[model samples]
Target: MDGQPGHEPDCKSFSYTSLQGGNIPESEIIVAKRKMDPKTFSQEYEASFESYQGVIFYCFNRTLSASNETVQPNDVLHIGMDFNVTKMAAVVYVRRGDQMHAVDEFVTYLIRQQ
Candidate 1:
C-alpha cells in the first residue's frame, strides 16, 4: 500500500528502556548494546518483533492516530477502554469524514482491580 491514495500508514518508534512496560530487561538491553550504541538498541524494534510486540508496547495506542482530522461537536465520538493486569488506559477518537483522529487520551497504572 505504499504510495497508494488515502493510505496513511502509522509507524510509532519506541526506544528500549528498562522501565515498566518495557519488554526487554535491563540485562538484555545492556547485552544487546555491547555490539551497538544505546540509541541503536533503543530504536531497534525489528529484531524481536514477535517477542517484543506480543508483550504490548503499552504506549503505542496513545499517539497512534491520524492527527490531521478535526473533531466536530456533532461528529460521533469514539471512546475506547482497554486494560490488562499491569495498567489501564483510555483513548478518545473523533471521526471526521471516514478517518478517526485521536484527540485525547489518558493512562493510568494499577490496572488490576483488587
Candidate 2:
C-alpha cells in the first residue's frame, strides 16, 4: 500500500445517488436519470458518441432546445444515430439539394422488454 504505480490509495469515486452527491436537486436528478440510465448517470462515465453537448452550439442568435427549423415533406432527412443496448441518441437534419439544416436531437435510455 505504500507505493503503487498508477494508483492513488486515497482517491475514491462516488455516484450522484451516493452519499457524496446528495445535495443535487430532485428535478435535475430526474432529468439526468432520464437522459441516461440509472447506472451510467450514477457512475458518471461513458464513452458516449454524444452527451449533453446540447443539440446545437455553433450558431449565433439561436437557442439550444428550441429552434424555428421545420421539415417539409419533400425534404431529404439526414439522421445520425448512436444506438446501443442501454441508450439511443440521434441528431435530425433536413437536407435540401445543397445544404443541411440542423433541426432536432433526441436521446433516450432503452427499456428492457420482458
Candidate 3:
C-alpha cells in the first residue's frame, strides 16, 4: 500500500508488461531522440545573439525537464546554445526589463574546416 508518492510500483501492471513488449512506440522513440539530439543548437543561436550585443551569457547545459526552477518566478535566467557541428557551445544570462537585458555569456567551439 506504500510506495514513492508518484512512482508507486504496481505488480499487476508489470506482470503483463515485459520490457521488450512494452517498448516505446517508434514515433515516441523518434520524438525522444529528436529532443535529445542537437540539444545545444538552439542555445547556441540565442547565445550568439547575446554575444553579438556584448551581453554576458550565464547559464548553459541546463536540465530540460521541468522542476522547481521552471516554475519559480525570477528576474534572471541562464540560457544554453549549441553549434551545428557539435563543436561549439554557449551560455548566456538574460534579465527581464523594458527591452530585455543580457548580463553576460560565454562561447567555445571547435572549428571544422571542410
Candidate 4:
C-alpha cells in the first residue's frame, strides 16, 4: 500500500495487512481501497449506491443521452415554468422532426422581505 495518509472522510477504512492477506491481488485491492474526492463521492457515489445499488438509472428502462444541438430561428419553442416565493425555474424545448429536445433551463432567485 502507498504511504499516503488516509484522511478522506467518505471512503471506507481498510487495513493493508487484511488486503494483502486476502486472495485478491494487491493491485485490485489497492484500487478498490483508493480514496474518492469528497464532493464527487458524496454527490454521485453515495446517491447512486443508495438509490440503485451501484446501478445507475435503476428506475429508468431507457438510457438518456445529451445532444449539442441549438434551437433554430424557425423552430418552435415551448416553455414550461415553475414559480415559488424564493425561486423561479423554466425549461425551454424545441421540436426537431418528431422529437422534442430540451435546449435550455433558467432559474432565478427572488428576495422577499422577512
| Highest-lDDT candidate | 2
1-114 per-residue lDDT for model 2 (tens digits): 324545677765542334245666678767776886544564563323334344323233455445567877787778888675567787788865566677877889777789
Task: After the best TM-score superposition of candidate 3, give how far the Cα of residue 34 lies from its true spot, in angstroms.
Answer: 33
The TM-scores of all predictions, comma-separated, are: 0.37, 0.36, 0.25, 0.40
lDDT per model vs. reference: 0.60, 0.61, 0.43, 0.57
| 2 or 4, greater by lDDT | 2
lDDT (tens digit, per residue) of candidate 3 on 1-114: 334345556622222222245454767545654764343333332222222233322333335321222213555666666564445555454544444333444567666699
For candidate 4, write residues 1-114 as lDDT tens digits. 233356555555454444345665767544544654343343433333333343222333233434566788888889877674467777688888888777777888777789
Alpha carbon lDDT at 112, candidate 4: 72
Q: Write the per-residue lDDT of candidate 1 for residues 1-114, one digit (tens) a residue.
A: 544555545634444434445776778666777965444455673343333332333334445533756567687779887675667677788876676778776788663457
Q: Give RMSD (Å) of candidate 4 vs. truth.
A: 13.2
Which residue ranges in model 1 land beyond 4 Å of their true spot?
1-71, 111-114
- lDDT for position 110 in model 4: 79
lDDT ranking, best first: 2, 1, 4, 3
- Whose TM-score is greatest here? 4
Q: Clashing residue pairs, candidate 4?
A: none
TM-score of 4: 0.40
Worst 10 residues of 2 by lDDT: 52-61
- Higher-lDDT candidate of 1 and 3: 1
